[model samples]
Target: MLLVDCSNCRRALELPPGAHSIRCAICHAVTRIADSRSLQPPPPQGFYSSTHQHQPYYPPPPPPFTAPSPYNHAPRGPPPAVHGRKRAVICGISYRNSRHELKGCINDAKCMKYLLVNKFNFPESAILMLNEEEADPYRHPIKSNIRMALYWLVQGCQPGDSLVFHYSGHGSQKRNYTGDEIDGYDETLCPLDFQTQGMIIDDEINETIVRPLPRGVKLHAIIDACHSGTVLDLPFLCRMDRTGRYVWEDHRPRSGVWKGTSGGEVISFSGCDDNQTSADTDALSRITSTGAMTYSFIQAIERGQATTYGAMLNAMRSTIRNTDDDLGGGGGIVTSLLTMLLTGGSGGGLRQEPQLTANEPFDVYAKPFSI
Candidate 1:
């Protein structure tokens, strides 16, 4: 077992046996890496008896990443094996009170699970999927728990421990006192209680959970919601919605707090904008392409078509244009998530994939992502 010098209590403590990660025994402040190898300390029962090292929370493992239903090759390898102690959480909530609404969310969770497992090879045990139905014995209902779990994962995260957080659900704008609905910066995962009681607000999500994460972790978050039709050019807007034609104008104010990536190193995939609706349908159930923005994001990452984050988004938006007739969703919102991601508040030129090679692992330099 590795040891960590709890920055909180300033005491050296041995980590729990087989513990992939743990919070400090004293202040509960998280540790990014195990203690320096030169010094090994006694177990947690030592001098800091009052300091209790709480087990960091981890959400449940996502649903098995099923092989593509129609693919001929058998996943190109064995069912993904767990790598180290990396973790992944998928929260899907599609079935709601009304059958017509069929608000399918967390579907991207399964797709994300497959992407991490098969493509990235995150360890099976470390990968966590938290659906509305799944119970995380180590976790609680608050999104804060998930966020803390993620923080711990990244804090103690090793080279191979990749963290992927995927949420597939509805996007909405909460009306502020100013009489304008603002895009919730801290997007939420639709829990089972979402219909009865809406999920956590983006504000609470960013403040409570996101603000405290470690600085450098390979964490990626994808929200298949539309954050702004203005940041990214809107594809096929429904003529019925009368949502005036999407102008390629940039709406992010230079001084607004919401303009930058506050989530830190975590790339966000918003479904639709503050004023738009991210549509859902059973149409792609028969097609290979995931019509949803999040799924398409995963597919782009998987096929290596979109290498860097920016390139990937460009490819996603292009897919919408190419398959506009195929997906049949006018507004072709496929690249909506990527738009907000790369723009970083400014709608810039197309981003080229970072130079890469077979000898070098895939690396993205998208100016450290944020929600």
Candidate 2:
């Protein structure tokens, strides 16, 4: 039996290796686990084969915590006046191919930048925000910004350091596989000019970026894409076409045709599924558009969900899935939401009325995804 948890949400379960699912009792959410051993070794690109190349993954060593600095949150006195810099890299792949893609990618990156700065407390100087035309988010020319981010992680990030990677745009499966799917692979978010003959695959995500994260560092990778049933929904701000009211697409398509798996030291909050498309809003609001998943994620951390990776992710999943709206079509959202709520373990922080758990085994309509 494998100790499995939702990569998108923080639902936990002891899953039999072959068993596809385990429902969350509280939220009635459904989650699918595909690839295991994804984080065993550090790979060069997306989530693909055993990218570690024989190097074993060391669960980052814990750093000693000394007195909190009066100025910064650092452990002790200011680092030797300049030990090393803590950095973050944010990249959005919007503007590739179509207007929709551009909108989504830009929106996705903007939201992440906010979380890193506003939520994670990273200083603006520490972050590198790379939108469409900007040269490099990670500095590598050939590899995607995500790849470059992973490159830094593999070489630079320390155990206690926090690193985040957020991507918004379009994503597909199997387009660039290292040959690991039983079903045809998936394809997603590529530049407008991304050559059809050669596309980026999920493997690149798993191998280079996800798998290579250094030990001890707490990572939160919030991905807004299709087929991301369990992913944290980033609220895409938009005006209701008919009412002209502000609205949020809190849910995306959560599906499974190909085998999906999870691993690594980081926590992943995906958007929708392979067959689904993330909701994109117009920039007319003049304010940054936020992914519902991202909004909830940051909120949870602020509420103390940062105590553990599992708690934080579950909070995101539960909130997004159960958000109430007058809009129609919940067939997809309901199932995914419930699964996330039930399976998501304790969100670390305890509210007055806790919802569900292995011991409680009770059910309730999850609270809304409001901030």
| Cα RMSD to the true fold for all candidates | 16.0, 18.8
What overall lDDT, based on C-alpha atoms, would model 2 receive against the true structure? 0.41
Clashes of each: 32, 71
Evaluate all candidate structures by whole-model CA lDDT and list the values in order.
0.41, 0.41
Candidate 2 per-residue lDDT over residues 174-259, each given as its tens digit? 43243333234444445334554344555444444444444465455566655443222121211123753223332212332222
User: Candidate 2 regions off by >4 Å?
Assistant: 1-86, 96-99, 102-104, 133-146, 175-179, 195-198, 228-264, 283-288, 302-314, 322-371
Cα deviation at 299, candidate 1, in Å, is: 2.3
Judging by TM-score against the true structure, name the best candidate: 1
TM-score of each predicted structure versus truth: 0.50, 0.48
lDDT of 1 at 84: 55
Per-residue lDDT over 1-371 for candidate 1, one digit per residue giving the tens place of the 0 to 100 score:
44444544333334555554556421445655543221233434334333555544333343343332111211111223233545766655555445523333544565566666666667666765655445543333234334434333333344433466666654444443432122324334444445565665554444332443344444555556544222211111111115532112222323343422223344444554445555454544322223256544655564565655446655555443343333334332223233322321112222111111110112333422211
